[model samples]
Target: MKIQIEKEKLQAAYKNACGCVKDAFEKLFGEDVLETAKPTLDDYKTIKSYEDACDVLGLSPILSENRNKALCAQFPDHYDFRQNMPKHIIALMKLEIISRALWGKSFEPEPDAEGNKIYWYPWFALYTKDEVDRMSDEERKSLCGALFGGAGHGAYAGFGYLTADGRSSDSGADIGIRLCQETEEKAAYFGRQFIELWAEYLAYGFKVTEHLK
Candidate 1:
């Protein structure tokens, strides 16, 4: 059977999902959870001035500049100014969070031949197949939580802090929040109570109640 989710219900679901993630994050990292990473504008200034912000901050100044130019060329006003800047800012913040969480964590290379460490982005590559194979199930769960939880925080921050028109932080936040909620679900599936609830309340099915006018 199909289930319909009204606007209020959807909002409630979103809130519940966010709460689950926040709770899990607190349990893992302790009381000062969101404070684990704070964003800085130094990278923004550097990128605006055409410096190598990418090396330290995982942001490509050249790409960002090109994006700005393209956006200006297309939207020319508040559209460009409001949208891209917030997304980039949030991306940098997320990178910082990931970097801090991953520091000193053991992540080996692939192929058992190349000794190079894995690159942090794309998230899936956080652990190689071999590395995962070597880990106990509990260890694997912790790694999964670290990866998803950290990313979820970044996405959550983006959603909470950034405001933009189309393709706003909601996109990333939805993915991050869902992944985080799934962590709890996976724990439950394994007969553990790592988290109290599903990140999302509407996991079964939900249909839009109305279209935005």
Candidate 2:
């Protein structure tokens, strides 16, 4: 079926999903965890200067020169602004909510085979219900697994987040987020919940409307 989702319905579904995640974080960790990890919208910005790049989520220069050789080396394709910046920003927003859910608990630090620290991060992406239903399990893994930009790749089409176990986090920003679960059993339940949500709210729209048939 061609799943149709209304804008208000989609927004509501997302809000509920976010609430579920937020509650799960509180249940696993504590009430204050997500609150602390949540940042003001201004926290991340696309700026013209490389000096500010490190301090922001992304960088888009007012001047072409601002995205210098160093930034090109650092952020690669993402340093420059694109038509898809809004989508990218939205992904980052969802990531924050999910990451905050992970905050407050401590997971085991998984080291690489070489004993180097392997940083794991959650990879979240939104697909239409019809889009997700068309893909096989393997296809889903291959496609949505790492939709985020990797260390050196371009912003959109390169690679996504790193995963060691079922879930991961950057050791630098908030290690405790990964450790939010009070018990090891539920350590990374957020990953499962999001994947089951089946393209976030798109699935919910179908469920609520009984329109999947």
Candidate 3:
């Protein structure tokens, strides 16, 4: 089956999600909160790496506190700043992971050993189309649910490691679903949407839920 993505529709949905995040942030933290908390490039240069920036800037306390509060609102897990991972960095990680999983088809990654550069495939590309078609309705639903993972749910999905050959050696590997050549337009779309999605995630502390709004 030929895969087709509605780029215009996706753009609109991404814009709407941005708006939702903007509104939520403005309502909860005031309009200028981000500007107030903005970190400068000089500030970044003072730290050894992005992961350690929060520790140097004393942001670890507030960010980790808020994150743990958010997590506690949903789960019983209690998180601390001992690991040097800040909320903003974690937010960036979440955005990058979700965008790569969902919008990766828009760009072409480096080719694998077989000289195949599968662009624009879902993370769960392990199953063939025929295999997917053979599954019962209930099974398909469950599979899709698992593939989507904790994208919009209460938790965030963890990383899926790839081996040297770019194949899944572990359980949650990112074997792409769709394969196609990347275009300039698609690359631009991915770049723009990536920034928007990252900003939205930072502002609202949630995954995008309005895809077609």
Candidate 2 segments exceeding 4 Å error: 1-85, 105-115, 122-188, 196-213
The numbered model that scores best in TM-score is 3
Candidate 1 lDDT for residue 212: 8
**Tens digit per residue, CA lDDT, model 2, 121-183:** 333334567887899999877765455334233221112234453233332322223323333
Ranking by TM-score: 3, 2, 1
Candidate 3 residues lying further than 4 Å off, grouped into runs, are 1-65, 68-71, 80-83, 86-92, 103-108, 112-189, 194-213
Q: In each prediction, how many residue pairs overlap at the backbone (N, C-alpha, C within less than 3 A)?
A: 1, 8, 2
Q: Each model's TM-score?
A: 0.19, 0.23, 0.24
Clashes of 3: 2
- Residue-wise lDDT of candidate 3 within 82-101, one digit each (tens)? 33665456555543443333
lDDT of each: 0.35, 0.38, 0.42
Query: What is the descending lDDT order?
Result: 3, 2, 1
Residue-level lDDT tens digits of model 1 in 62-151: 333345554455445433232355444544443333333222133222221232322222221334577689999999998788666755
Clash pairs of candidate 2?
102-177, 103-177, 105-179, 105-180, 106-179, 120-168, 120-169, 146-160
